[model samples]
Target chain A: MENQKERTTIVLFSGELDKAIAAFIIANGAAAYDHEVTIFFTFWGLNTLRKDEAVNVKKGFLEKAFGWMMPRGPGKLGLSKMNFAGMGPQMIKHVMKKHNALSLPQLIELAQEQGVKLVACTMTMDLLGLQEEELIDDIEYAGVAAYLGDASQAKVNLFI
Target chain B: MENQKERTTIVLFSGELDKAIAAFIIANGAAAYDHEVTIFFTFWGLNTLRKDEAVNVKKGFLEKAFGWMMPRGPGKLGLSKMNFAGMGPQMIKHVMKKHNALSLPQLIELAQEQGVKLVACTMTMDLLGLQEEELIDDIEYAGVAAYLGDASQAKVNLFI
Candidate 1:
């Protein structure tokens, strides 16, 4: 029989642009190394998977407040440090473009094309009052148990 | 031969109080499960290992600025969210005390008592101009290669 592919998992727990980019870059690199990679987005990390445009979804007051308050999608995320009222992300994007490095959105697409599994944490979605329609297409929804199962089996598991 | 202990590693990359607490909680839990746990402190996360009082180590102007600017230790870190000019940490500390949860310092002591390996990233120390004298005792200093080696061998590797 053929050998099984090595597995890697990342729990994306931060919502900032720089952290998300770091998480995706690592995930893509692991996928390139032929690992069966899974990026499980939870808590504020779920913001990375949101669609850019506003989604028409009915929600309670708190949920609506969350929707309005949180950044809509990857393009809207701020840098974790040196944000300087959102200018840090712009500088980072410019530097990435100049260096010929893939932007975070492009890196994410590359991950998807590389068959890296993207799983959104359902429990966090519930907590953040986010709906499936509000997220990008072609991702799976799961909870902590699923993540724990994957992480327990994978040698490279990161909570980013 | 006896079974090998399950290995786990965590890269503490955030310096905030809440993140440090979370990292220690997970590390402590994994250790309790009989895993050989290692927490490699890097970047801002190295602040978690610092001594509260100022150190007499000589440094350049830039390094001195970094040392002066960054939080002194676990007790000085701010919350990641809702910092409210440092009030957030105080509130959290009060609540943790009320709940009888171990404070961050207590958690670090417990980690030490449990023989959990605490490694400070030497590369980060150099970058931030932190001398060995500035950090707490009973911990190690290593670079990224050492961390990658541990991560590759461990089943659970988290970057927090």
Candidate 2:
């Protein structure tokens, strides 16, 4: 029983601002409860791990276009709903500040501090042409099999 | 030991056609593995359970507007990406038919036949003004707490 810690895994598949926030909030909450948590970022969810600055990495035209089109990082993601252009993210950020809730970046920091494992899906990175240098540091890189391994054993797994 | 069924739970939170198909595919896959699967539909996911035809339920102006704006059922939902107005869903349906893949409605039907528990979020119903008559039959109406109870015991829980 000592080695059997509670485990939780989350697959963040959406790039929307609200969904990412919800994913992190739940991850942080689970980590606080002493569960071993992992957030597997795939598809558009990879945008959450990207650096805000443009990285000078040579890529094929389609890959470059994908990288250009996806959001740079947590700050630039748009809302899944009510995104009146870029205003929805601004309003949500404003409200979050007003309510003293931790920002997305801050939530990531907290999750890292809480020892929640952050894994970026390597297959998605390859397909989208995202380089490790273009993403934030301290996160591990892996494939879907690794995620399934963690998920099959976890009592609370979520695809966000 | 015979009574201890492997449990899995999925929270379908997106209303898009592709996302719904993915949710059901996974749910069906798990159920095929003999896992007791529960798919808790919340927010826009409830649209998947809506009847193809509108029910003549009296509702407030906001509720009526919401009902009008949201998709009526699986056939009416849009794709999350590459949704060129309404053409994307049509193209996906065509491809699905050609590939002999189960359509979204058929997937839901298979889920029911596999004894997968299809649950609609009751709190969301109150907020969205969706009445029981508006949804398809045989689904249990529940809230988040009920979902949590199931999720806590399940080896896999996903919020899609």
Most lDDT-accurate candidate: 2
Error of 2 at A144 (Å): 13
Candidate 1 lDDT over residue span A46-146, tens digit each: 99999999999999999999999999889999977657788767766765675576888898899999999999999999998999999999999999999
- Candidate 2 chain B minimal-lDDT segment of 10 residues: B143-152
Q: Identify the CAPRI category of the predicted complex in candidate 2.
A: acceptable
**Interface RMSD, per-candidate values to 1 decimal:** 4.7, 4.7
Question: What are the runs in model 1 whose C-alpha is more than 4 Å off?
Answer: A11-78, A86-153, B58-62
Question: Ten residues in a row with the worst lDDT in model 2 chain A?
Answer: A91-100
lDDT scores for all predictions?
A: 0.87, 0.88
The C-alpha stretches of model 2 lying farther than 4 A from their native spots are A2-5, A11-17, A20-78, A86-153, B1-3
Pairs that collide in candidate 1 are: none
> How well does chain A score by TM in each candidate?
0.97, 0.98
Choose the strongest candidate by TM-score. 2
lDDT of 1 by residue, B78-141 (tens): 9889999999999999999999999999999999999899999875676568999999999999
